[model samples]
Target: VEHKVLAGPFARAFPDAEFYATDRQYSFPLNLPDSFLGLPPWTRPLPESGAASDGSWGGEFDHEVLTVKPGPGSMYQDAAFFHGPSGTLLICDALFAATEEPPPILTEEPEYLRALLFHARDTPQEIVEDTPEARRRGWRRIVLLFNFFFPTSAAVADLGVGPLLNLRPYELGWGGWMPFRWKSREAEEEAFNKYSAGGSPTMLPIIQIILSRGGSGEDTLRWVEKVKRWSFKRIVPAHLDAPLAMGPEEFAETFAFIKKGRNEVRFCDQDVAFLRAAEEGPLSFSVYKSSLGVLRGQPCGP
Candidate 1:
């Protein structure tokens, strides 16, 4: 995770600050243990219970734990805190949002620029001029690919099957690699438009897949209801554009696709074709209801 550079400094600077994490974070079932992932020795695990309220910070924060029914590819959970004074709902990754502007952090680096231009080109044979607009084009593609994993606008180009003349030159540093190709500029723009959705917040596309399958969505819905009870006017997720000027109603709307009788998906079906394929194949994430009517993700078999 390469978190030591940032996490080590922070942990040292404010050694007394309360540190909280879920138990699974330390003993992650699918990923590396916390010791290697960068958790300091002083860290403490948050309560395993779904909801844990702390009257600390002058009783201004309402901390709630949210968990999805675990599946083979499961292990999704987050702690949301409702700040009473600011009326802000703070979260880690339950929801996500990204503006069109290229994040300033990656703008000046040479490697980032090269990566951006990689997505800007139609194919290896075509040369794209390095420019501000070209860099912006690369960032847009990156955002789509990062969120959807393999948004509909791009597809892998099979170098093994293509003729030598069509292949890119070795001097380009990608002569033998299986690079992806864009379906069309229009397709890329269309997929991005759906993702932006007029700058509205949306849940992870994976959650949409679970709910679409056997997942009843009851567990997540209940968590949403719990969060809505707090008096928050703005929601701030850990990633992307923060402090969204939205209220409880707007925040609740993000999970609309998961509700029963809903036919629509969290994101466009075509846009998330790659995620869908991976879920059914290598990912194989699924959910079901238990005998007690509790919905959980189906665990992966050994």
Candidate 2:
């Protein structure tokens, strides 16, 4: 049955349990203790002899099901429910759609950079870089997500916080499990070596260049316009893959371009001439696009 139908009965059985009730939805928590949640008493652990294992709980009813929905004030909340073998309640949380503004981008800040690096420490830096291979092949950034039920490593990869950074998306339970095996170690090492030899890349130089030439407010706008033109033509579409996937030569050229832009910024910094440059407002760009299929397209009225 659907979650709505089950909510009332479950709630009646466990009144003190927290009920997350939105205007049009409801959910119950499942917080059963470990003692009551383990295998039934009659069942024994597997034997080395490999004889037919004893039937589970010796014919006792042994199954469970839960229904949940997103909770209020947060993406998810805890839930609890009971089972038959033992009258125990299980606790778990559920996630719902986001209903608030997303966090701002803070990529330029040193702290943010440090956190990003820390999260990526075990990852092969090359795969995530805009390497020559990435540029020639028209590679862009890759996005990966993991679900709660998967292992911690899988979850980290999903959140873009782990070693699986460069790899394409793969399912956890399916054949995708092979990628986590020991055989993949060699590939990871080779990629890491490549990244170490090549150096880190950043877009800060491009930002500096645009800001410098466009010293005034109008110039800043012009810089943004240039960015629009360049990005739409060369960068935006790269979002489909990752930078490292680009071919070697193209990646090298892109790195060189970024390096040159960075050096130009450094050169400008050495002189006091550009210090007084100011604009009426902050430089900003609208990266939002309808074709990207983000939240902007949702029909929900404001």
The TM-score leader among the candidates is 1
**Could you give candidate 1's per-residue lDDT for residues 1-302 as a string of tens digits?**
44223564677688889776666652223366676767788877776333444545677777777666546444556778888898998987777776666666566787766777776766665567888877767777887777776665444444455535465564334662434577766666666666767667876665565544444366767777888888888888877677788887887887776654453543556556666566556655343422222122211111
Q: Poorest 10 consecutive residues of model 1 by lDDT? A: 293-302
Q: For each candidate, give its TM-score against the true structure.
A: 0.74, 0.16
After superposing candidate 1 on the true structure, give the runs of residues whose Cα lies further than 4 Å from its correct spot: 1-13, 26-29, 48-54, 104-132, 157-178, 210-216, 285-302
- lDDT against true structure, model 2: 0.25
Q: Backbone clashes in each candidate structure, one number apiece?
A: 4, 30
Question: lDDT winner among the candidates?
Answer: 1
Q: What are the C-alpha RMSDs, in order, of all predicted structures?
A: 6.8, 25.6
